[model samples]
Target: MNALMLLVQKLSCDVEEHVFSEVSLAIEKPESYFEKFKERLDERGIDSPIDQLAWISLVDALLDHDLAFELDWKESGLYICDVVDELLDRKKMAYISWGDFEDEEFDELPTSQCLNEISGKLKEVGISLAYLDIDSDSYVLITVPSSDIDDIKKMAQEAGYSIQDSF
Candidate 1:
């Protein structure tokens, strides 16, 4: 699982070039970590296989957002929580998902106002704000850098919720 570990490490370390390069290489080489059918279709300029592009785009977005962190992620690992995940757990996060809302309807939602409201609410609970997606009506994810897990759990319990480990 070195490849998977490498991907996770790159993500945890916030190694931009290395991560992008690995993903690009994975796209090109068709490793066990990634499916190749989509890659092949991509190279042919066919539009049917979109998951490859979507996954790549998602990784790009994650890396873009990670640039905001002041600390080194490689040393930190994934022990720190992503801000969007926090908001989602609070039920204060919103996102456009087929399971919930459609893309067009989600686009019509008041995102800025919603983000502000969620931010304020999370702040009250001693949680920090991270990322919010208005167009998709989704919150990215957030985590306390050095906060106690017990305390965070307490806060979530107080809100009549529970926290789950994220992948």
Candidate 2:
């Protein structure tokens, strides 16, 4: 119900017939995620206009489940990809999410390997892991969820990464 969601919904509708509306309505049926998201945003005191828009983009992506990777990529076991080409601004780090996995899977090495691959790509663009959150039956905010920054950096460096921007 936020302005950015409205804009995205309107844009999606304009370009793709009824696709956006149907998706939006479906997502709204279970309102817990949206409600918690609003609370998280409020707690962060995110008053900036750009941050607001980013939040909207995040929500829209979540609603659509439009982030499934190709068979080739999924088989490679990675869960994210560079979306820099799709970014409106070069300075902003853009990434496309892959399909969701259960929260328990996140703590495993294979999962981190997948995430690390994506993080490796992002680091090439001077971006590090900002954070990742999951909102399904349980709403959670995972800030620096990884066990060690050194480990992440080592993995990234092994993947031919550059200096990541300070978050």
Best by TM-score: 1
Over 1-167, each residue of candidate 2 has an lDDT whose tens digit, in order, gives 44333433422322333444433543454244434345544544533333223434343443344221111212223222333222212322244444343244543434335555545555554444433222222111111213343443444344333212232
Worst 10 residues of 1 by lDDT: 70-79
Clashes of each: 15, 0
Q: What is the lDDT of residue 139 in candidate 1?
A: 38
Positional deviation of residue 143's Cα in model 2 after best superposition, in angstroms: 15
Off by over 4 Å in 1: 1-109, 132-167
For residues 21-127, could you state the per-residue lDDT of candidate 1 as single tens digits?
54555445544324434554354354453334423433443444453222222222112223344324443434322222323443344544434444454455664
Candidate 2: residue 83 Cα off by (Å)? 7.9
